[model samples]
Target: MQLRIKPYNKNAFPLKALLIKGDSVRHWVSEIHALGLSLSEVDAYPVPGSSANTVFGCFVLLHSNKKLSDLRMHEQFQSVRDLLFIPSFSTLFPAMSEQELRKLFSSSKYFIHPETGLVELPEPIDWSELLIVPVEKCREIEKPQDAVFIPRNVDRFQIKAMPPEDALQEMEDQVFPKKKEFEDKPLNLFEKGKLLFYKLLFTGKEGKQGMFDGSDIKMPAWLSKLWPGFGGTWFDKMQEDFADLEERNKRKVDKLMEMLENDPEEALRYAIPIDPEGRGRGQIGNAALDFFTRRSNFSLFGTDGRSGSGYAVDLGDAMYDLQRQYIKTAEELKRKGDYEKAAFVYMKLLKNYVKAAETLEEGHKYNEAASIYLKHANNKTKAAQCYEKGNMTMEAIELYKELEANEKVGDLYLTINHRKEANIYFEKVATAHIDCARFLKASIVYRSKMNDPEAAQSVLLKGWRAHRDGNNCLRCYFDNIADTKELGREINAIYKNDVSEANVDNFLDVIRHEYKKKNELAENIREIAYEIIAARSQSDPSIVVTLKNFNENDKELLKDAVRFKLNNKGK
Candidate 1:
């Protein structure tokens, strides 16, 4: 019975399998089919017990115990020689375990999936291992028309891997051979003097021979022969060159000083050059730098005044130019994403703390900005602002308190809904602003945020004490009171302990007006009014007769006046 085998396509499985040893070829073929692997027709064949010997175009199964050497001599096997070979382990080496077989073939490359019973060729067969049989005795074999032979180069394959460092050293040894080492000997005094003299001359303006046509100077040919050695003629020439350079530099220095007096800003343009690499142009460069430093009053290299030179010049213009240059350099550094270096230049060199802080803030470096503002700029308010902007509320509040900005402290506390802390700051604000009559703002904060009416009332009362018009302030307090009953009780308590007649009269009028407006009940008003009049009668004795005469026509008023006089008769 022929099994219904699926048609083969290279896209489904591009790899081909070559199976050897027919002893278990039937079982191996079944396993390969179960793995859904496509096999080349040239390499695959069906065994007797294999399911339905229907052959696909790719898989080739060889059912024979043929050695690789014997198979390579066959024309059919030659076409699929390059394809992957899978030989049954048991058939190839009887009584051998999988581990033993793998160890025996360790030098070769192969793949094995034990779970799927899948295997591939460990290595290509060695053609030289084949037997050399005579053509007359050998069986005739037909080769495929499209078969292509590929020759392997043994020398191209490396058996062992080389480490990178070892390979590099090997290449270096081949390219650069070792050479003898030479030691340097020190020069004598005359040779050293000649070297210094030549260096000075070469680096001087006169050394730039190319700059002037027909005015070039050259060392004598005999000097080259003697080279590093110095003699009387070389020494005289060196001294003459030194003297000429000195005179020229002195003239330049005089001109620079004149510019410093007339056009100081322009003098900055002609200031000494700073060679960052320290490649000095002999004595002139050093002398020019010293002159500029002294003129600018820079104490970095120590002033010449203490040395009795007293060559200090006005540094105002130079200092200004340096500050501007530093600011420009810092800005450029910031633009180049070098924030740390930029901050250092701004803080250490320029000392422009405000600009540094502003730059930090612009860069989203809030914590650093706050620190600079606090420590360097000494602006606590701005520091607190920075902290608050950065969502660092606790830090901001602490700074605000340190600055005595109580209102800001209270506002911050209130913003975070820390009512208890808000109330504490509000009370502080109320106390601080009491004399200024600004305590009411704190009272508003206390009432709205803390919901403490009594605290608010207490703050308002303290403010009213410091107010010039106590009567108007007291009236205003009553008008704005949250609870009218609470205000009435507070007023009753104040009036009961009163001793001054003028204050008593003011309280009486307020009570009367409040009673008329129904802000205070009739009974409480009457009691406070009696307390005020009795207190006033002690200072002015005619108060009793004036009240009796004024209320003579009103029965209730007359009765109340007599009751008041009788009640205060003991005092």
Candidate 2:
């Protein structure tokens, strides 16, 4: 099938493409029955666990989802579990809309974009519990493909050499056994033959070789002569093999002994099991000698199911656990102020933690271990720094906030949010009036540039408030004073000092009343109002009555003073 895959911008599953044997359906099914063991190349996450990144191939499986066996489940899940974490780490995954996630989950047999960290959807047409089965299947796609299926069951595909329909027909045709069509008949019988013997075998040091030891059956001279000489003595190879086996056993024995040390009396219970739990072994190699000799008669410890498989023993975990506790004890000693012993203990612990954490990463428990290390990180600030250095921003941000480093918080916000993200952390910046002023200054500039007068006014008001709060970061005080004076002058120009004295006095009274409540240049502002309402003291009864009775906006009769002066000069 030709398939197209669209990956999530992120995800949290084992998304892989796999193709197996393609020719005979029988072989494919056989491999599938064997837990798909032949296709080891695509088990990818736990380092080639079960995922494929290439396209174009086929596979067959014996069990579908309805009949998935334990072994088959294991083969699929081992890798599936390991790579599942890859999806959670995706930044893009969370950025997807809900609709995208639904689409991705509905498909299979796709490319997982390394960049997007998404597993693509399966092809449109498919049958069987193929999705749930521990089956061997082929995923075939274009050249330069993102993923390819391994070649185990690939040769078993029924459609390998023909069109889909023809292959299907061929498959159906092959199912019906050939009946009386062939011409040959079968022959069945048994026969016995006589044995040929060898005569006279030699003896005596460097002179010759002898025949076989006492069993009764004999061979012919030609057959015996055809036997090739075995290189080196058989004893040498046997001894070497024994030595290797012994060494391995010794190591296991040592491990067993160490394990018993944790609880000697109950050691036997763990060391020996009647039914042979496969893990129950009395001895290991020389390493576990004491456990073997003293603990129980069962010499082999930790086996494939009965005896021990050395590679499978969790020595790394054990040593790590041991060292971890040791370090903890040492840390307690140190916390009690015993610097030297604590240091020693800590060193031991560090080694153990390292080992433990490596296992964690392999077991796909990386985030957990990282969480611990993140907690035990040198110090809050130091750990935060480490996380940042390690590009673990998510972790760093979380812990750093606990350190209560507002400055650091500010820095991180500035670096990442770029001011536009004031929506998230505006309060943090709002803490410092000076900072607020700075923000408002920029905001005011932006507002004015956008021709948003109301926004500009708000920003200016914030800036003014900031200045009032003793945040004189930008010398906005002087500009504010200048504006107030200019406004006062404009109001004064709108009126003149020609009103009746009564009016000036009355306006001053209003000014004085307001000044008691707010004194922001109020006294000076009162003088301007006084001038607007004033009446010049003159011995002119006619103009006084004219201005006093006229409205505040009437022209002063003496407003013609300039004209009168010009005429007098001509006279």
Candidate 3:
């Protein structure tokens, strides 16, 4: 069932229309169900004691007056429910002129491109000349069971005759109020219904006077019959009866919840036989248990007749309520400078040790926060940080050392102006890096952090000799060493006769490529590179040939090196 969805432009109309194949009956039913969910957005608000927050996905049937089900009466609500918000998050209505339908749902899906005239309708549709049929007859085309079955013809639909202009506008405004540029508008049907439904359904005031009271908004007769708030006639009486039943159920569930919290064995025993009132206490208790365990799928908007499910405990909503109260209490305590009480609420009640610690820290109770972090949160790093923040230098150092965070310990010692202690830990960090074969890291820490070039040189040379396969130490050694004579001697000793031809070639290539600038280090390295290349040429003549080829490619840079190589070609 390929359902082609066509969305109406807000300027023309604000509804989406789906054109589907005639044989796709299942998709039609599913779409209607989706639309029912959409209409429920009108009731979507944070309801007290109910955690099923609302999400909407609505659609309406056109020209069909039959109420599908008493539970699913939203289908017959299009005329009164003027504004429909679909799953696509766009507002739409059922009414549209034939021309508007043709312009949107035609064979060519293009129209005038916004800010450009690149795409448009092939020809201007003539609504007057074309044989206009009611939208009801659209199903009669090839497939009879489909909704909005548009054919290739562009002029098949004729707009359904509507109510008066002012009446329609008022209803539309009530359903989805238009926002004025500067003026504040009253809440619309969705907004009002959301708050009203939340209060009526979740606040345990089901059948109050103002409950289901939308006497101000005007709607059609059929809609008023199914709708609770519109006329307050038959549906209101039905709602009152449902409310009475629901209130009784709520009390029973509340008792069960209290029992479950205080006495688990008693709560389990409570799920027993029917009482004198003939109400199934067992069923109710089981439902509450399911809800307590967070396995309840019973939605308030459920069309199925599941009486006990609605009364089940909503743990999520209960948790949300507790959290909201915690926030309020925490804020009040903070204002009164009672941080210990606030932290207790976060730690003991909320089980949020991080938040508890944060609250203590915010109140300048850093030691208390650090203790909480260490004991409850089991966060050593945060404990160390809080200790440092509290000016507990010894405590911070101990935690950091336990965590093997030597750098942090060094930083803390420096904060206390203990240069000797700081350098000791910093050197430990450098040595640890070298032991891990992180020679470049060790050199950087020694040079940058420790401010000891000699120590940096010693580590780099150690790394180079231990891991000659790595080029980091070799590059760092040459890049830092300022003694040109010592640099040449080190280069000679490093790439000796016993070194593999590949390793010697790699060493010379590193010096030639890295030390290319016209500096004393570069010149000395290049001179040493020529000697290594000439010696390697004794075993492998291709070394000089490769250098000559490089000089041929770019004569300016490699000319001197290539000439030196050629003069000592066989040495």
Candidate 4:
């Protein structure tokens, strides 16, 4: 039977199955919903079966909290023959074992009568009657045209079987045949004589000149019969060698004849006219240099040294003319691994101190590089970094200190195990942070590096009083408080001294959140909260109104304190 199956929107639920009933389309959506499972439903259709009968069914897409291997059909359903499990087209199926398939045929859950609390036992399903469709065949439901037919009532699903070991070997043999096996046939007299003749007259190997020189391999008589000009390779090699020798002799004779016919003055262009008395000083050396530079095609000479290249009357007056040559020379020296000389050329000739310093760094002359960076380039930061690279700690420390880089100075001192010196620099950094109202960073430095919690608290309190914006600092301080009585004192001091009519409500809200837990510490904090309410209530009558929606326990205590403080104010 042709069935029209299509992909549905429930791709998220990977475990899906079609419930087919040839009799009628029966939906157990409500029964499945009773198990509190997430399910998606699709339109009903006929299922291909063994009998020529129209089947009707809908698909139920679902995900089980249990693993796919552990999933089974709900046992409460009565019609076991109706369910047909298919792979989802939109979602990929993991491997399903035969046992998993059988378990899925078994029911998953018991149906309970919700109103009467009656349990309906599941009907058993025949495991043999269930169809085990391969996931690949089922997923073809994605293509509406090809999804029409799925074979049923088969003994086994048409899964692609792996080839047997011997079969695989036979296939491999056909694909990659073994080399020609050994065979023997005794030669007759004519064949044997012809083979011997060809071996003696025609065999040769290709020589270094790419001509066939000589070898023992026999040539076939057919090749000789096909081309009349194709003599054996040995004869060809001898002819080629003789021709080459004759060509060499002809070239030599032509060179001699041309030399005899030429003008003699042309030869003197490269010859030095020597004075027997040594009167012509530098002539021979100049002639050699001209030859050498000409052979180099003037690549070795600068423009100033090249023939017919004019220069300024005063060469020093136009220094820019020499700049390009200096740059090219420096680059050549750098490429040739002469970095020190390259640095010298950049510094003295080009006046490029940065390039000089970088070149010296490449040469690993860190001390000289650092000096050039500081004195010529005026980059003290880079100078300090260079000194540090060279392990010159003292020089780096001085430069960092001069630059007001206290953090680097401190780290440098710590590297040398000078803890006291490091702390001195760290204190400078912390003091600078405090001056800029960076109380959080200053507190961290004092607490973590200096190991002084009291100084940290003092800085946070100073910041709080000056700017009224150190809530984070205060929270950090309170989080580190381990001792209960010290916590009480700190809380009491903040409540009594830190409150103003404008900020008193804010402090109250902070205390309420900070000490919300019910414990002895919180009880003490609550009493302090009431004390602050009492003290502030005498001055600002509206403080009690702010405590209206406070924590129940603290609000009651604060209200009593406010009444007592107002009575005292009246007296």
Model 4, poorest ten-residue lDDT window?
A: 292-301
Task: Write model 2 residue lDDT over 73-144, tens digit each, in one string.
Answer: 222211122222232223232344445644644443333333343343333214232234577889997678
Model 2, TM vs. native: 0.20
Model 3 — TM-score against the truth? 0.39
User: How big is the positional error of residue 125 in model 1, measured in Å on the Cα after superposition?
Assistant: 94
For residue 78, give model 1's deviation from the true position in Å: 99
- Whole-model Cα lDDT of every candidate shown, in order: 0.50, 0.36, 0.51, 0.51
TM-score of 1: 0.34
Work out the TM-score per prediction. Answer: 0.34, 0.20, 0.39, 0.35
**Candidate 3: C-alpha lDDT:** 0.51
Q: Which digits, one per residue and each the tens of the lDDT, describe model 4 over residues 186-241?
A: 23445435433433443333222231233322334555577666767765654454
Number of clashes recorded per candidate: 13, 60, 9, 8
Better of 1 and 3 by lDDT: 3
Compared with the true structure, what per-residue lDDT tens digits does model 3 show for residues 314-333? 33334344355555665667
Over 28-91, each residue of candidate 1 has an lDDT whose tens digit, in order, gives 4454444443232223433222234532122243333232333221122211222323332212
